[model samples]
Target: MSGEPEVHEEFEARLKTYEGRPAAETGVGRDPVNEPMIRHWCEAMGDTNPAYTGPDAIAPPTMLQAWTMAGLTGRPERAAAYDELLRLLDESGHHAVVATDCEQEYLRPLRPGDAITFDSVIESVSERKTTKLGTGYFVTTRTDVRAGGELAGTHRFRILKYAPARRPRPAPARRPGQPGERRPRPVVNRDNAGFWEGVTRHELLIQRCTDCHTLRFPWLPGCNSCGSAQWDTVAASGEGTVCSYVVMHYPPFPAFDPPYAVGLIELAEGVRIVSNVVGVPYDKVRIGMPVRLEFRRYDEELVLPVFRRYDEELVLPVFEGVPE
Candidate 1:
């Protein structure tokens, strides 16, 4: 991470030579197109399209890059040109890297049991560029993913490798497992102050667009349906169903238990809210399960909204049912 800033004039021309060079040659997929991975992807994306399921199931077209992804060991037969280019950038003090975006074009449908392979080329390397992140070049790679010797898709990926413009603010060391370590506080701005105030009184309030009367969640400043800035608050019934959920198991955070279920509850009013589902084991959390909202006090100053299952008595669901 430590490197002296070198003269940009010395290496800028060298960076241009990397354009149109091979990045990866004949990179093979770690796994063949299969049903289990497709099923998992569908479940997580909440994509219920029948084309992704049943007999004659073709992999989702949007999953073009997914089929060619490399594992931790990295791309098989990766060309040295890309490596040297990145090293040159690193040596020039552009050590931070982040993927910006990707564009995919599907040429053919990829079915299960299809073997995937790809070849990538350095599409372009921009000259010294300065952005909010810092000064560095934007490197783009174009990959042609193939199946059975036929082009199945084209994936264009872009990344920014740059030096940090400024150091990030230091965070206090946190021990989430130990008692009394506080979770980071939420930002209460002018636009969202009312929502937090409603939480204090244990009222789940949603914004209703004054123009179209459409209900919106998380207290948006303007209505998405009609683009109206005028809106009013509507008290939710707090009864809902689990539309989707995820079990967080890694990268521990303050005051949170790992492997916990975070549910997206579709409320009776038709809007959805995301909160922890506490009544059942994390693994037992199921889509379409009934849930009811409740306010929980984590500490004297922190009270959060969580949900409990309809049938399971693992956790009590008590809201006091105050009049809205």
Candidate 2:
């Protein structure tokens, strides 16, 4: 409202000029459709379907845009009109860019030896809108892909060019004895309701398959090993060893202290569970340290199993017989 009205009007007029204009046309793919690229794509996606391999291979439909990429040198087919539109946005302080989403439609399969080509047009430009990232415009472009002179796919991509908004820093974590702060609530569904119920009663329960005798934690309805739905609970021996651990330090949250140790505890029953390793400094927590399970009440309603390491004095004697 404070700036010159004529200048603002000129900017809007320039942006509208790009709509329905060619962003890129008569663009030829740098490489022909081949099996090697398809194999690499399938391997990276963990897609092992037989149709994507061997003599009958067809490139994955999602690779429609990959064929038309400009690479590091950029596309010569791009029109100067698209570049001018972006330059105008940058001049208006909307410099940052992030791709929002994309939609694709495949009409025919792309097979080996098929040459690829494409044409793209500026689809639409949205009115200025305010978002968490800041105020910006949404620009959309639609590309039509052709293979062997036939329509193969259509891809629509949208991006937001914005001036980023500043976010306030997160609140500091509350101290151990502070009031008005609680741990994040656990997600309890029917599949794991029994496990949470067991915790409320100061019991650590593991599910055991009734048919195959295999035990699993984080309770599930069916046994993954045998696909059996029959199962029962077993009380743990309350003994375990620290098999692995990690220290969290970033993106501090109000509910958790930074630089705390979370460990994967291998229980004596041959199953593993994750819990906070207490009774020792976070930095001192090591793999294979013997620990015993105990219940801790964070507040009146929450009680969880935590592992406590044996006192350092008690563990030192066991290592005294060996050389340092």
Find the candidate with the highest TM-score and give its number: 1
Backbone clashes in model 2: 0
The candidate maximizing lDDT is: 1
In terms of lDDT, the poorest run of 10 residues in model 1 is: 315-324
Expressed as tens digits, the lDDT of each residue in 113-139 for candidate 1 is: 999999999989887888898777899
Question: lDDT, candidate 2, residue 213?
Answer: 95
Candidate 1 RMSD computed on C-alpha atoms after optimal superposition onto the true structure:
22.0
Off by over 4 Å in 2: 1-10, 167-324
TM-score of each: 0.51, 0.49
Give the TM-score (vs. native) of candidate 1: 0.51
lDDT of 2 at 37: 83
Q: Identify the runs in model 1 with alpha carbons over 4 angstroms from their true place.
A: 1-6, 174-324
Which residue pairs come into collision in candidate 2?
A: none
- Check candidate 1 and list the clashing pairs: none
